[model samples]
Target: MIHFNQVSVVYADARTPALDGVDLTVPEGELCLLVGPSGAGKSTLLGAVSGLVPHFTGGTLHGTVTVDGRDTRTHRPRELADLVGTVGQDPLAHFVTDTVEDELAYGMESLGIAPDTMRRRVEETLDLLGLADLRHRPLSTLSGGQQQRVAIGSVLTPHPKVLVLDEPTSALDPAAAEEVLSVLQRLVHDLGTTVLLAEHRLERVVQYADTVVLLPGRGRPPVIGSPAEVMAVSPVHPPVVGLGRAAGWSPLPLSVRDARRRASELRARLVGEPPASRAAEAAEPVAEPVATVTSLGVLRGTVPALDGVTLGLSRGEVVALMGRNGAGKSTLLRTLVGLHKPTSGRVTVGGVVPHRTPATELTRRVGLVPQDPRDLLYATTVRGECANADVDAGAAPGTCRDLVLRLLPGIDDDVHPRDLSEGQRLVLALAVVLTARPPLLLLDEPTRGLDYAAKARLVTVVRELAEQGHTTVLATHDVELAAELADRVVILADGEVVADGPTADVVTSSPAFAPQVAKVLHPQPWLTVHQVERALGAAS
Candidate 1:
């Protein structure tokens, strides 16, 4: 029901069109995925459907974008609000009401929907989004995932025919991401609604998508086809496809279930045991395990944040802490550094209790990179910021400057930290943390809002640090990142340790935690593209 005919969009100050000579169409009741690396103009397409392209985000537009037979050039966002519901990446940005119930009913009330209908729709939406328990809670009290569902529920309650979501699962943990994706799946199946979503994490959601719209890259045609069809050949692919590629499988699998059925025959034909490359590589770690937590219980204000938490950190190891939102993953990390004084826990780094030590001493031993490094950055320039870092960070002015320029080549020495793109700013903020050269580093969602190239830059930099003997512990929902960088895996759920072990062990345990390659293995858990390659290479 939406069509873009040779659509080209240019922002008010832009030199080139955001969408250049693009022609696309989506039929009614279709759930289409808009996948690409960041800044691939997926958002531009969503804007046209929601009438935000020409109306809200003012820009010079060319060609026709027709939605439901009405030209978007003529229709404003409000005029099409009844036809489309738009949920953005930043859930906190879209909230219009203070309370959950009021937010759900806000749209219907604006559309002059009757009181009874509004109430019914609100109740139905709360039930559908599984927000009934939190119906009376204030919007501010909800977590990022909860707020996101509420945002979707508010729009869906109005009975919009289509939903346009930008990075819906970016901020969620595995379980929460699945919860939202499941709700979307149900909406499409039961309600016959259209879905167009743009996201960086494709492995988790691509299987559910009926159609895939691979955006034109820096220089390429946008590929459109069935999920399997496009995924089989797309350059921007889930790691499982890489496994399928290396394995030379026919009609590649989108999920483990499909891969398992096909892989058994292949496994039977395989020869001897694979080389112990990964195990050998792991054994060579030069740095010692200075921190170890055994049978630890993490508690926060009467609620168990981490129950029976146990893990050890080797100086050269990069362990990815994985779990869904409200899973107590972040709590476990904070407790490690004594940010949240655990009621019943022991975190020791080099035989020194983490929480019992002075806050200043903790900085000397462990460095934390918060989710929004913005909270930590206050200086006016790249030069001034690092100078102000806590001395334990070991950040002298020269050391910080060199670190900044090396990580982000184009980062202006004089530009305000806030002016940089999300990824650039993160790297710059991290530069400040690195100057101190602490032995243990903790990062919380370090890759949010980054473009594809930028993410690679970060992974490379972090890998270098790990190679140099820094214990890196990053808390993130990015499974691919986890698979690519982490040496170990731990999963937290509702302030309790549900899974902990080597990357393969934990991933194998949680189906939701499995990466694309492991999906090919079906029952076996493989967390990264490298692991898939090794499995296929060994099997070959």
Candidate 2:
């Protein structure tokens, strides 16, 4: 259904081509997953399908890209609207209406579909995506995951033959991600729709893809094959695949269940061995709490978003806030950063109430990296953004730029902020926040768009900060990341804290939040692939 022949895209000012000499094809009624490292041109390849590459992005296309036998170079996105539906990473950017129902129907209305058919498709999409109960709610009030589902449903309502999605499940929780993937499976099997998607969280969607498209970095050619064939050599992969490779398993397993079936000897080897503990556990305790939430209760439009939640963070502590969608994780972060005022209780940072502090004073006490990094970025170039951050934080001129270089090496400073990849943009936002050197740092979803290599750099940065007597709290759904970086885990459900303890105690006990390594090596107390490898090495 989609074909690219000798495709290469070069932007106006870029010296290197985003995509270089790529030839690929996606058959009808199949789901193709595009996998690659950050800045490897996965999004550029996806844009080529709907004619957004050269038409809207103002780039030059060397080769032809066709969808349903129609050349994209000759046709604009509006001209091929009937054949393709595209949903980007940011859902709020795609919405034209206030409520969920209206947003879903806006696309059909633009296409001038028959009223009867549009109404039927709207209801069908709402049901299929599990948005029936939220049909009347405003889009801005929903959680990040719910907004993602609504964005996808809005496109699916048009009933196009080809669907293109970028990081579709990055914002969703585990169960909600499964629901979205299952819907894609049904579309491919029952309805014969062609689905092309790019995702960073490969563990969630790798098992469900019909075929995998691997884009190696450094301007290499693309590799297309089955999931197993591609994952065997793919640099970016989930923990299960890494475990399979470490143990020399043939035909690397894609899912935790398959790995568990082949893990008998591996489990026995790690029977009585305990994993290495984090440095946070052995460090000296703080004299007093850096931030404290006492009976904190926040209300969002008559709904209790945070209910009587009491927590404390000490100096040099790293805590991970985890929960399902709309379980008050983001709400709690916003409360700490003074974005949301508590309705019934109080929150104090350094013994001063966050909600009552002035904006300038609050910047010195706390900093928050929100889920959408674009909200904090407005400068045209990367260098300008870093300079603005330094001025805003009252830091040295080159402080922010130095942090940016450390977080993302080799990124062009003269490039426009809008032209950077999602991961690079996130790192830039983080560098802006770090300029203030706030005592308390909070990240809503830190690793949403980061690849493994970038994530390792962030891990090192956060760990160094913790050692330097900074308090950190990050809310995330990436279990492997939590397993690696978090000293403690705090879980919330329905606006209340359900569990809070050491990382090993909380994540290993819960199935939903456990990483793949823990799932495969059950009852062994292993949390990460690195830990398992260490245990094996020690035993040998």
Best by lDDT: 2
Model 2, span 1-540: residue lDDT tens: 999999999989886889999999999999999998888888899999999988999889999999999999999999999999999888898898999999999999999999999999999999888899889999999998889999999999988999999999888878788888999999999999999999989989899888999988567999999999999889989889999988879989999999999999888777888888875234643656899898989999987899989998999898999998889999999999888999987899977888899988888889999998988999999999999999999899999999999987867889998898888899999999999999999998899888877888998998888888888898998888999999899999989999999899999999989999989988888888888778778888
Report every candidate's CA lDDT: 0.74, 0.90
User: Model 2: residues >4 Å from true position, as ranges?
Assistant: 279-287
Per-prediction TM-score, please? 0.82, 0.97
Candidate 1: TM-score? 0.82
Q: Against the hidden true structure, what lDDT does model 2 obtain?
A: 0.90
